[model samples]
Structures are given as structure tokens and as C-alpha cells.
Target: MSIQTGDKIPAVTLKVMGEKGPQDITSEEIFAGKKVVLFAVPGAFTPGCTMTHLPGYIVNADKIKAKGVDTIACISVNDAFVMDAWGKSQNAEELLMLADGNGTFTEALDLVMDGSGFGLGNRSRRYAMIVEDGTVSHLALEPTGAVDVSAAEKILALL
Candidate 1:
């Protein structure tokens, strides 16, 4: 089953392009003691993702924080390098871009979507979840092929 509210995030290492170098960070490191806003997109730089999904989070990050969020993260199936570049391109310094390159975490959460038809291999569905102290508190997942439900503005409204 897909991870749901009250479920602890699966323990897995996610690659992040850190200032020093590539960092392998665990879900525990990210959500163990923090109230985190985590959102996933199908891929980096896709039309809907770039134009609305990620930018909504970037634009409303401070408001999300005011609701007691400790961190806001954007996740995708792309690698650290691409995620880093996308973050830079979007001017999203305040958000964390996590690279779930291998899809271990995505599969564990049952969120992986096959994109081979698009020649993109496997990717995460567009979705967002709120985690507190390692457990999910809320989830807003897009219906397959739908974009309106998982937008950052909707998530911010939840908070």
C-alpha cells in the first residue's frame, strides 16, 4: 500500500548534492525530529512540474514555514546532479532537493510510476506529504495524470 498518514517514513538513503560533495542522507536525518513538507514530482523540468508544481513550493515556502514547518523538500526520481541543477535553475535556495535516483525510497512508499513509455524509466508520481517526527501526518496525492491536486498551493492550504 502507498504510505499514508501515521506511517513512519521508510528508512532509506537519499542522495543530495551538498556543498562539500554528494551526501547520502537517511529519512531519519530529515524527518526524525522535524516537521517536514515533502513533495515529489514525476521528473525534473517537466512542463507541469517546472511551471506549477515546484515553483508553487518555492514561492510559498515562507508561508508553509509559518505553519510550523521546519523544512520543505522537493523530491524526484532524477539523480543528485540533475536535482541540484534544477534547484539552482528554479532559484529554490530555501527548499531541499532530494534525489531518489535508485527509486528505493519511492518503491518502498509505493509511489513509483513507470515512465518507460515516455523513455524516462521509473519515476515518482506527483504527490506531497507532511511528516512530523518521522511519521506522516497528511498526504495529498495527485490522481494519475492529474496536476491540480498535488500543487504546492493545495499543500499550503492543508497547513
Candidate 2:
């Protein structure tokens, strides 16, 4: 089943680009003892993800932080290298770019979507959530091919 409000985020290792190379970070390390805004995209660099979804979070990151969010992170099914390149291209210094490299974390949440028709293969569905110290306080899941509900503005409003 898809993750719901009040559910604890799954324990999974995700990758991130580090100075040395791709580094692994567990879900517990990311969410524990922190108020985090975690958002997921179907794939990195895809039209909707690049042009809109990710930008919303990048632009509103400060405001979200002001509401007591310790971190604002973006996760995609792509590898760490691609996610790092995309973050730099978008000037997303304020946001955390996490790679769910094999879609393991997405699968664990039951949020994986089949994107084979688009040649994207297994990917995450568009969604965002407020995770406080490892538990989800709010979850916004978008319907297929939509990005309205999961926008940062909506999450900010919730905060």
C-alpha cells in the first residue's frame, strides 16, 4: 500500500552525489530528528519534473524552512550522477537531491509506477509529504500525469 499520513517512512538506503562519489544514506538518517519536506518525481530531467515540479520546491525552499522544516529534499528514480547534474543545472543548492537509484525506496513505499510506455521503466509517482522525525504528518499524492496537489505552495499552505 502507498504510504499514508502517520506512517513511518521505510528504512531504505538512497544515494546522493558527494565530493568523492555517490554516497549512501538511509531513510532514518534523513528523517530522524528532523522536520523534512520530501518530494518525489517520476524521473529526473523529465519535462514536468524539470520544468515545474522540482523548481517549485527549489524556489520555495527558504519559505518552507521558515515554517520549521529542517530540510527540503527531492528524490527521483534516476542515479546519483543525474540527480546531481540536474540539481546543479537548476541551481538547487538549497534542496537535497536524493537518488532512489534502483527505485528501492519508492518500491518500499508502494509508490512505484510503471513508466515503461515512456521508456522510463519503473519510476516514482509524483508525491510530497511532511515527515517529522521519521513519521509522515501529511502526504500529498498526485494522480497520474498531474502535478497540482504536490506543489510546494500547497505544502507551504499546509505548514
Clashes of each: 0, 0
Q: Estimate each model's TM-score.
A: 0.97, 0.99
Model 1, range 80-152, lDDT digits (tens) per residue? 9999999999999999999999998999999989999999999998899999999999988888787776777
Alpha-carbon shift of residue 125 in model 1 (angstroms) = 0.9
Best by lDDT: 2
Q: After superposition, which runs of candidate 2 have C-alpha atoms over 4 Å from their true positions?
A: none
Off by over 4 Å in 1: none
* Model 2, TM vs. native: 0.99
Candidate 2: tens digits of C-alpha lDDT, residues 81-117 = 9999999999999999999989999999999999999
Lowest summed lDDT across 10 adjacent residues in model 2 is found at 43-52
Q: What is the lDDT of residue 96 in candidate 2?
A: 91
lDDT of 2: 0.95
* Residue 81 lDDT (model 1): 94
